[model samples]
Target: MKKDQNDRDSAIIIPFPGLKDRYYEKGISSLESHHFQEAVDFLKQAYQMDSTDPHISAAYLAALYENGNYDDSKRMAEELLKSGIGSFYDVLDIYLMILIQLNDYKQVVATLKPLFEENEIPPEKAEHFLQLLKLSEKAVRNQVMENSPKDDIPFLHQEQSPQDQLIGLGMLKDKNIHPYLDSLIEMLSVEKVHPFIKTAILSLFKENKIDQSILVEKLGKKETLNPMDIPSAEEFPFFHLVKNQMESQLRDHNPVLLEQILDMIERHSLCLYPFEWEPTNPSVWTAAYRAMGYELYGENWNLEKLAEFHSVQEAELGTIFTFIVKLEEISSAIVSPQ
Candidate 1:
């Protein structure tokens, strides 16, 4: 659509059918050689002659992108996508990359959301799409917060409904949260606030590298935390440490046992999160999860083997596993998905 492109077209002689193939071959070679402008020139002619050819259209889109013609790249990609001229996902990916290069992050977020909700992303491409979704969302959130009239900190107050607080906290990610730090820490101290909300606040603080040392009170226990040095609130080590040890032990063989134990640990994570539980003895819990995993599969559940595998004493592993089972019974309601 440039004046030069139009001028080039005006000077072109009428081409026979075979000429388009020659143009395509040269265009693809130019693209591979990083001669983007030449690629664009040749591919544009090929695409104009055979717009229905998916291969030409795809190559033309790439050429336009490499030529730094993001607007035309996006337009061509969308047209190809709408006409079903190429692989749907491939065209979609090209369209998204164009949006990203143009810094049209809001559009990027809007485009990806439905694909995720409908489970339409191919399994092989899911990770790439998820990463794009996260990146765009952060960019969009920062932009929205920059233009907003008020910060979302007020939503963390005790009087607000948990749903509203959660909504507000969701808005707070990737922003300069320093102004809200005191309020966030105070919310953590308040016993009446939803435990889930408190956890979210702590996570936000931790992610932004809060510089101040602070006292955190949750589930009736108090600990002084330096936000920069600590894990994200959801990433508390007790929940993950046992799983890590199990991976070290059962990874080469008995992967089934390792996976089952990790699931058991995840269930416990859901139950105990934002609760004050810390693993003073990770070996005991690791052994406990292993025992329960073996029991569930009707496999041999030898106490000695479990303790030795986990480097915990046999009698102590038995005793603590009993206690953990009892703890899980009372905490069962917390892990229900809904």
Candidate 2:
């Protein structure tokens, strides 16, 4: 019975036996589908079966790279270069990309220098290589400056006042200002931050096109709060209604409505405090906008008085007030209890 069982097993022929091509085909298909990890799995199997095949090696290396297995990809690329197999420049490009990601700019510079001097880089690729070389050189210089002695830093000796710091930050060239973005945002979010600093930070964010929705929302909430830190909704029903509508629009990601709200605040600010708009003192923009709702709607001023205060025609003020009424109706309809 044991002999018969062995004979039956031997008779059972495995389909597609030793066919590494099948695994390579599946691996390439997965790679093309952007399933990098799946590609790596199949390609690794194919590599194991036919280790000498250049196509298998390249596909496996690419799969490894795309899957973010940089260490393995680098090792594979180095092996391919040492073996003098497949496309030398192609493998070198992959190796260089890995090094760039690893921030090994020195190695990148050393490797490319010899290739550039030997004129081995293809003309089509020469431009790209030069760009990488320039970026690497810049990165190396920045690293050196950062690692230099702390006492050599000029700003260390100079103590800047809050106002002076705000002015200095506002005057800094946009190209060199990205590193301070998080710090600026933090300052903007703090209610206790000097108005001048907040304004400087807002200008920077506006110039850089950083999303200011979070800052805008925080400022809006703070504007709604009274001196006692309680929401002023109980004292000003119209302001409360308008504020609720604005919050709903913001939650819905209605950019048009959000921009309209910002524009209203800005226009009101300009009208209420015309002389405060100074380029040198940017904090007035925030102060002006924050005071808009309270000064107009919260004060319960008549239409004529409101128009006169804003230096606008009664018709314009009436239209804006009517628009707010419409927004209130829409918000009520959506949020009304069933």
Clashes of 2: 0
**lDDT of each prediction vs. the true structure?**
0.72, 0.56
- Cα RMSD to native, each candidate? 14.4, 18.8
Using lDDT as the measure, which candidate wins? 1
Structure candidate 1, residue pairs in collision: none
After TM-score superposition, what is the CA distance of residue 107 in candidate 1 from its true location, in Å?
A: 11
Q: Give one digit per residue, the lDDT tens place, for model 1 in 1-338.
A: 55787799898878886989999998987776567999999999999899999899999999999898999999888888789998899888878877877768788889999999999999977876776677567656666554544433346546655544654565565666666666778877787776556666766776776777777675457777776776543477766677787888788988656655665566555434445344478878777877777777788878998789778888888887786676556344333311
lDDT per residue for candidate 2 within 1-338, as digits (tens), equals: 35687799998866478578988988987776567999999999999887779899999998999898988998899899899878888778778777766667788788888889999999867865765665566556666543544333221222433333432352343344455554555555565444434444555555666643434212223331112222222233333344454555453675444444554543333221212222222222222232344443465446666455445566655555554444334333322321
Residue 8 in model 2: lDDT: 90
User: Which structure among the candidates has the greatest TM-score?
Assistant: 1
Per-model TM-score on C-alpha atoms:
0.43, 0.42
**Native-to-model Cα distance after best TM-score fit, residue 87 in candidate 2, in Å:** 0.8
Q: Candidate 1 — which residues are off by over 4 angstroms?
A: 1-167, 192-199, 231-241, 263-280, 295-338
Model 2 misplaced regions, further than 4 Å: 1-18, 144-211, 214-338
